[model samples]
Target: MAKDHGPTVKDDKLYEDLLRDGASKGKAARIANAKAAGTLDHRSSELEDRSKADLLKEAREIGVAGRSKMDKAALVKAIRMG
Candidate 1:
């Protein structure tokens, strides 16, 4: 008989906890990391590599405060430091 093989995976609760704390591009990256670790869904990985402007746009969508007045670099920093 053939042996069964299963996919590798990571903890899902950690990712969810981070997300519940805040909604931002940083959270998106956490989700991406979980996906890479085979835990969360692989949807935001591309977002992890996006440019500052693009990241800011995504952060805006996630409803980061003061985003509309922030510059691209500031947005990236806020998102990453959140």
Candidate 2:
């Protein structure tokens, strides 16, 4: 069973599952909270469909390193890994 992560973690089970799947603590928490808030179903645009400028903007928002130097494909990969 998953340990309770207290009130701040809205979905402890999902958070534990995400941790087991190698997601970082922050990432898992964000996803868990989003799921609990019923907002996870709203998908963002696919990386492949976005222009380089759009990808760069997202990369910047997410604080991807060296985003200014990354190409579209690289940005996509980085965002996924991030």
Candidate 3:
């Protein structure tokens, strides 16, 4: 069983899985909560369509390593693979 992460974490198991997958604590909590709320199914822009800055921001959110040194295409790949 997973340890309780307090009330802010709506889905503890999903949050733990995201953490194991390299997501930051905040990102894991947010995604888990969104999944519990049934709002994670919304569509977003393709990685290519988003600006490099946007990609960097998302990479930072998801705890991608070496993101600062990567270019736009690399950022897209990292974000996708991440």
**How many residue pairs clash in all the candidates, one count each?**
0, 0, 0
Ranking by lDDT: 3, 2, 1
Assess candidate 1 and give its TM-score to the true structure: 0.40
Please give, for residues 15-37, the per-residue lDDT of candidate 1 as tens digits: 44555667553564555455556
Best of the two (2, 3) by TM-score? 2
CA lDDT, every prediction? Answer: 0.57, 0.82, 0.84
- Best-fitting candidate, scored by TM-score: 2
lDDT of 1 at 33: 58
State the number of backbone clashes in model 1: 0
Residue 44, candidate 2: C-alpha displacement in angstroms: 7.5
Q: Between prediction 1 and prediction 2, which has the larger lDDT? A: 2
- List TM-scores for all candidates, in order: 0.40, 0.63, 0.54
From the highest TM-score down, the ranking of the candidates is 2, 3, 1
Candidate 2, residues 1-82, lDDT tens digits: the string is 7799998889999999999999888778877987899876333568888789878876776679999998889999997776
Which sections of candidate 3 miss by over 4 Å?
42-46, 49-82
Q: Which residue pairs clash within candidate 3?
A: none
Q: Local error of candidate 3 at 73, Å?
A: 6.5
